[model samples]
Target chain A: MKPAPFAYAKARSVEDAIALLAQHGEGAKLLAGGQSLIATLNMRLSAPRILIDLNGIAGLNSITLKGGEVEIGAMTRHAEIERSDVIRKHAPLIAMAMPHIAHPAIRNRGTIGGSIAFADPAAELPACLLALGGLVEIAGPKGKRTVKADDYFKGLYETAIGACDMLTGIRLPAAPAASRYGFAELSRRHGDYAVAGLAASATFASGKLTKVRLAFFGVDLTPVRAKAAEMALAGGDLDKAVAALASDLDPPDDIQENGAVKKHLAGVLLRRVVQQLTETRA
Target chain B: MNEMCDISLTVNGERVSERVEARKSLVDFLRDDLTLTGSHVGCEHGVCGACTVRVNGEIVRGCLMLAVQCDGASVETIEGVSDSGEIADLQEAFQKRNALQCGFCTPGMLLTAQDLLSNDQTPSRDHIREHISGNYCRCTGYHAIVDAVESVAQARKGSRK
Candidate 1:
């Protein structure tokens, strides 16, 4: 497999990248880690007129704690997030789910922004962001704007990022005191895309679960928040929570598995995650 | 906009300058232009680990990267590292254990194995398997491969002692 002939431009800054995007409009594709983009190019699934390489743009690869959130630059690689003590302390779900993203080699070059912007239904980062109540920062010709994680993801491979916009960074709220994190996924292989997965965050308060958020991926067009299941769990009805998944998620049949099978797996994951989170307290 | 660009990067240890198509993959550049065929081309879509290599000190899928994107970067392939004797111990261990049968996936397997050993000297069997899970070995079924890597890790620890 080989990519079609295309021109390449390396942007020196985010503004430069935006300018390049503005110039090319929909004809150009922004290259972050190139892990997924390059593959699409090689398969000729995508043939952009020009590739605007964002790797040369500085300041998009830093991980910092600002105010009450952990700010991760869009160009930040997955491996960096896996080892970052700040993430491990502040956004542990992202850290905990890092190894499942891919193998060591792929993680070395794949960027957090790429994963989020690509918006793969089976991806871990987007689901983690949703569970953590994170935010995505997008930059366009009119300047920068922030989109809530709840509003950022639209559909399969579709995001709030417009043709002339670029995702600059993502900010995850600092973990609350006594908050517990639970993350697990099932795949044919460890690094393959998940058959079904769950990322949940909840605060254990006085023998009761409060502010519980369960984000399930590989079970919908986008990472879905299981509010019904969360409500059931918060009300102390574990059986109801599991049963509520039928109303919460309606996964479509994919090449890997059937929709009914995916719904069943999602229920299984909810139980396991709840058990794991509660077990940590004892 | 030019479809071809000039790039000057270090391959192995020597600096090389050339003009390549922007669409050309780094693995193809190495195998065709530099004659460093140690890194084989399997599935070009980043699934198969047949084209694993090092760029700027970290391992990446060679096919997932474009040669033009590696401008000014330092790259290392199996041939380069093998010639430098960096993975000599791993090579010997693989030979002794018969970890490779077809040898098509050996280059990527060795690079991935060395990557794990260099990072953690005492990786568990499960951890080793997880780390190299991306590299598909169709023949060995991975039992012998894991054995070889584990033995080398123990030997390196012994040498240190």
Candidate 2:
């Protein structure tokens, strides 16, 4: 399968890319790492009239720490994040999830921004971002603005980014003193899309769990927070938390498995992650 | 008519210039234009690593990348690496171990295995399997391929010591 013919424009700057997006309007797609976009193009699932290549843009591939946040460039490759000492030290959850994104070959070219922008319900980054309370930086004709991860993901393959807005970068708060994280995904193969997954971040205070955020992916239209399960966990009722998943998740039947099976597997992952978080403290 | 872009890039250490359609994948350009058929195209998509190649020193799915994207980049295919003897030992090990049956997946497998050995010459059997998991081989069932890679790694390590 070959991609349909399209005009390509390499943008030298974010502004240049934004201008191209504005000019092409709905007929253009921004090429980040091209891992997902290119596949869709080859499958004839999507055919944009113009491709605005953002690879030539500088300053969009750096990882930096400012104040108490780890700011990662949208164009930063997954391989870079896997090796970044800053991410490992400051945002361990993102670091923990990097190797699971894809294979080494794909990781070398897949971008963090592209993953988040695509907002695939089965992708790990969006769920991790939700669990970390991260912020997505967006740039458009009106300039730049930040959207909370909770608000950033709109639905399956949808995000807060508009037609002409570019996802510039992501800012995640550095892990706090008592923060602990747990991440796991179940897939047929190591590199295949997950059937079900969970990314959890919580803090234990005075023998009580607080600020628990459990984001589940591949279980809904978007990476969703299991609010009821989170409350149950924070309140020290593990059994209730397990049962609360019923109220929290309603996964649709997908290619990998049925909704009930995915829900059961998700519960299994939740138990494992909860054990990981609690056992570390013990 | 498809739009074309003029690009100049180094393939297998030789500098060449060509005009390609904006949508032409790097694998197609190499096989159809440059006549470098070592890198086979299996799935045309990124799932099958049959189109794996090195771009700027990192292995990437050739089918997932546009040729125009490599205008100023350096690309190394199986032919380039094989001709230069870069993966000579790996190739010999594959042959000696009978790691391939159909040979369709050999080019991509060698490239992937070489990439792993280059990173960590002492990779464990599990690590080797994981590293090459992206590259699918329907013929050998992967046991022999893993054996071949492991043999080379051990040989390289022993020699280094």
List interface RMSDs for the candidates, in order: 0.6, 2.0
Give the per-residue Cα lDDT of candidate 2 at A89: 91
lDDT of 2 by residue, A126-159 (tens): 9999999999999999999999998988877889
How far is B68's C-alpha from truth in model 2 (Å)?
0.2
For each candidate in the order shown, give its overall lDDT on alpha carbons: 0.93, 0.93
| Residue ranges of candidate 1 with Cα displaced over 4 Å | none
- Pairs that clash in candidate 1: none
Using DockQ, give the best candidate's number: 1
Q: Give residue A78's lDDT in candidate 2 (0 to 100).
A: 97
- Model 2 / residue B109 / CA error / Å: 1.0
Fnat of each prediction, in sequence:
0.91, 0.70
Instruction: Estimate candidate 2's alpha-carbon lDDT, on a 0 to 1 scale.
Output: 0.93
Worst 10 residues of 2 chain A by lDDT: A273-282
